[model samples]
Target: MRYQIGPDEPVDVAVVSAVSAAEECAPEALPQLTEAVNPDALNEIFAPKDEGPTRRSGTVSFDYSNSRVTIERNEYLTVEPLDVIPTP
Candidate 1:
């Protein structure tokens, strides 16, 4: 599953929402994202600095709510099931 973060969307919120949707569970049911990553730092990494240029590159991956979640360029995000069995 893939989710796009709005220009003003909070990274932490986006992560929780995406993970919840991917896991088919309520956001409240999932463990706190801070348990896996620091929300403040995550936001800071992607946030523009003093009207500077937007973040151009970076990727963060972590396991959350039974899925492998990834954030790229602070805009594109994806979640993949951890239990999937690859078939050749």
Candidate 2:
């Protein structure tokens, strides 16, 4: 999910975890439900200094049985490099 932060925006980015409905609602195991979510899976993709309001797109994969989540691939919105400067 890509969100635009204004020029003077004050915000904090955080990584949490993925939750499964089957695991979260079990009455017997509350602590295990918390453990199933991996905090490391939450990653923050920050924009470069010269770039602002960048658009990022990516695919994510998750395996509930093994508790595995991987960011498959991603694309960044950028401008093409200029081969030569125009003469005014």
Candidate 3:
């Protein structure tokens, strides 16, 4: 994921793990909600309205890549093994 704090601000980037159940050995599912652009707009739309709100300035854009979701199951359905694995 890549993030831009502002036009002149620093750009932050990272790779996010999208898996929900790693213990089951299933491929990580891509996040349902990814890539937040123009958090300023989001803040305006969802920003809290209360006293003593800390003031901050800056815009951030989050870039994300979608991952595939895989299903796994045991032959005996005993939940002993998980079969799905994500391949990079």
Candidate 4:
């Protein structure tokens, strides 16, 4: 599943929203956001800096709710199941 974050929306909210959607549950039903990553640190790392060009080309990945979550600096979030076995 892929989700887009609003220009002004906090990354943490986007993460929670993604996880909730993937798990078919409400955001509040999921584990604490901090368990996956520090919300403040995440925002600060991806937030536009005052000096130099804005960091717009990076990705952060972490495990959340039994899913692999990838957050892109371009405001895109992707969630995928982490423990799937392929059938040959």
Query: Against the true structure, what is each candidate's TM-score?
Result: 0.87, 0.27, 0.19, 0.88
Computed on alpha carbons, the lDDT of every model, listed in order, comes to: 0.88, 0.31, 0.28, 0.86
Question: Of the candidates shown, which would achieve the greatest TM-score relative to the real structure?
Answer: 4
Instruction: Report how far off residue 27 is in candidate 1 (Å).
Output: 0.3
lDDT: which is higher, 1 or 2? 1
Backbone clash count, each prediction separately: 0, 0, 0, 0
Candidate 3, residues 1-88: lDDT per residue as tens digits?
A: 1121232321211112222232222334434333433434533433334778643443322333332222111000011112332335
lDDT per residue as tens, model 2, 2-40: 223343332111111222232333343324323544433
> Candidate 3, residue 61: CA error in Å?
14
List ranges where model 1 is wrong by over 4 Å: 85-88
Against the hidden true structure, what lDDT does model 3 obtain? 0.28
Candidate 3 vs 4: which has more lDDT: 4
Q: Please give the lDDT score at residue 49 for candidate 4.
A: 89
Instruction: Point out the higher-scoring one by lDDT: 1 or 4.
Output: 1
Tens-place lDDT per residue, model 1, 36-67, is 88999988887877876766899998887688
Quote the positional error of residue 25 for candidate 1 in Å: 1.0
